[model samples]
Target: MKLEMLDTSIFIAYVVGLLIIALWISRNEKAEGRNTEDYFLASKSLPWWAIGASLIASNISAEQIIGMSGSGYALGLAIASYEWMAAITLIIVGKYLLPIFLKNGIFTMPQYLEQRFDSRVKTTLALFWIAVYIFVNLTAVLWLGGLAIQTVAGVDWMFGMIFLAVFSIAYSLYGGLKAVAYTDILQVVLLVFGGLLLSYLALVEVSDGQGFIAGFSVLTHELPGHFDMILSPDNENYMNLPGISVLVGGLWVMNISYWGFNQYIIQRALAAKDLKEAQKGIAFAAYLKLLMPVIVVLPGIAAVILYPQLTSPDQAYPSMMELMPVGIKGLVFAALVAAIVSSLASMTNSISTIFTMDIYRPLQPNKSQNHYVHIGRIATLVALGLALITAQPLLGQFDQAFQYIQEFTGVFTPGITVIFLMGMFWKRTTSQGALSAAIGSAIFSFALKFTFPDLPFMDRIGLVFLLCLALTVVVSILTASKEGDESSNQSVSLDEVSFATDRGFNLAAIGCVIILTFFYVTWW
Candidate 1:
């Protein structure tokens, strides 16, 4: 599937134009010299739209587009619970979590932990995150993205990886998060438009030139099982998306940890001008999440009828792109690249932030702000270099790298979630308790998995989360000082933080819930 010259030209122009715009957006900071705030937090000045767009752009990477599409082909719409549930999660974060983070005026998630708990808890999680980001996350994105480029554009996989790495660094290393966030608006716009166009064309094929509604009708009638929002216990894919557990079980723990506590994802909200602006941006992102399935998942469902002979489910998305015209193919390819590079830039920026602010700055606390910013840029380059060197060796051998990554991360997510939730709301939560939860997450997760070989992973995560929570509570109670000093400086001052939302935000939350309910009711 060699790209026509016109398609190749469109892709090249998109790449060049994005580089120009990203550099241009950050030119003032480059000329004037960036401080730690400017380089890492975007100078605390992101508007609602940029925050919203950047959040989605940074989130929907090659792994998601390709992986979720694969799930759509294999497990059907039940996999969409991840995205749809995340919309509600964003709203909860905005209403409850963002107020605490913004009130503290912190730079990173680890910084917040340090404020709420102790240095031991903060440093432990910080190191864990940095290691995972560099080894697991960065490598997976580059490898999966490279494979995607090879499939869609007929490029060599090695070249595709290098190109993505170089492109991400070119625009982002100099200007940092400000560059990444501002440029992400364009990336997200292209992603939405190109994805929607591809989906529309796919549906048209299913309808044999009939319109979208008719095509949708044909699909519903022919593939009724594919439309199930919740799987039955007897279904073969039940382990992947357990029947009712997605709504009430470990999935909530996973979503809260990712949306509320993850550095790369939450950095967008942290950079906003105020809590209200951040809340608005979060609400905006919630709506975009609601639309993601149509773009990323529907094409795979349509592919069941369009390309039945695909050797692997992951091939469904790129296989469907064969329906596009030449010019349209270029636009779609550019959109795919947009998703990849945006996520790369966002991840690298966050890695630099955690290292520079949480780890390096504490060790070298006397350094000037400019010096710290310089260190951040260097850290970004170093992390990207490491990922590039190790991408293939780390991920190339795995037939299901994305699933493996999720399972590995799941081991730690429950403990992490317990730490954050308890630290935020429970004044009795001690530093020792928090630290125990961090270590116990992995221990409890693995212990349960081996003990109950037949237990569904989602149910295991839910059970592990409960065990971690109990461990934290019991430890905190036993370790509390007689004079109350144990919980004194370590707890968030909830009285000083306000969780009140404006009328518009309340309305948006209601709308999101209503829409999600309609989706489940219709599909079920």
Candidate 2:
């Protein structure tokens, strides 16, 4: 049970690197007139490729790299369903979902919902997403990043928490969307490289005289059913209670909302130079998603083969890092730091946007734009503080770091995804429909969460997702769009974004879907 934790040298180097990067990003954000638009949407100048890479990196974070892989280890092959499903989701977003978004020149997903449905719907989904990303996802994000920092860098968690909060707020608040997007591009590169290094190291450990296959032979003999698609219900394997259905369903619901609808993530794509470039960004991310299992998941599987007696799956990932070859330790540490900072920076920017645009600016319509920008910065700092404090209770609380976060996200995602979808394409969808889906999904998820708390609540995302969809459709059909508002418009243009890059991106996206489908059938 007692093992060498982590080298303090590696941890220290990572923190130092993080500081240098954060300061560098802050400098870039200060370019003249980059104020409002620059801070919010990266001045809408982010090319599709930058937005795409950033989108993937921002979405991956510590949760996907560390936590999700931990789940892959715990659940075996079933957890991989998330990545597989996510690829398809992006395709749908690119083809069916995006035209509506880009066409309206919408700033936030909520804004589009407001115009198509009602302001009340916009506010409701906006508030729900805020709670999920900020209160729930944001807390875990900081905590996990802090945990990684503490393990690799040597700062105590309380201090680590503060360090993450301060650095994340400093630049994200200062740079706005521009900082987050560009930094995301940087983070994605680091994350992918880290994944490659980690996989190579793991493969080397397993290989013997012949190399990879020889090394892989050890796992086959050591961990029976390590590759099992169906895990026992009583066991920790992903197939346990939620089963393959939830695996498929949970992933379907989450990715659709995450890639297609979530504002913070989508905003990156929205800033693309053209539709083609936007598509490229998304396809690039999908390609990366396919590779993640090899990086994040395989390690966990290898950990089980190598360190089977650890007695806890959560220990699997950290155990691998502690045992990695010394020369490569620094790279892993650097990559981990990148993941943490990228996520922290993202959430900080998004929460600040919500506070300023959704709540404050509306309330104070007469305020100078300059004054509003100042207020946005202040709100970012406050959010960082709250997130840090919120993360405090989570410290050392959950045995499995990732699941704790997913369960929380599942509750809010169902409602947010439902309302956003209805409000976007369905003109007949009324405020009443949006309200019901949001309120209904939240109430239903809450009830189920309490009634079956320890169960794989991923089904919770699906349950309310289905319900909200049903309610939205039924309500829209029943009440209809306001008499004069026109409920029957069905053609949303593919060129809604009107940017230069999107068409090429669409071609790339189609190619990605083809590749992903091949994988799905083969994997299936």
RMSD, candidate 1, Å: 1.4
Q: Which candidate has the top score in TM-score?
A: 1
- In terms of lDDT, the poorest run of 10 residues in model 2 is 488-497
User: lDDT, candidate 2, residue 148?
Assistant: 65
| True-vs-predicted CA distance for residue 60, candidate 1, Å | 0.5
Model 2 over residues 1-524: C-alpha lDDT tens digits? Answer: 11123544655555566556656776766656645566777766777668667777777777777777677667665566677667767777776676667666666777666666666766776776676666666777787776666665566767867777776665566667776777676677777887777766675676643566665667656655665544556655542326655446665777787788876788887777655666666777777777777777778877766667865566566567765666467667667767777777777677677767776777788887677778878877777777777876753577666777666666667777777666655556666777788778778888877887665667667777888889878877776635345652332223343334455566766676687666545444
Model 1, range 154-271, lDDT digits (tens) per residue? 9998999999999999999888899999999999999999999998988888999998888988888888888999899888888778889999999999999999999999999999
Candidate 1, residue 496: how far the Cα is off, in Å: 1.1
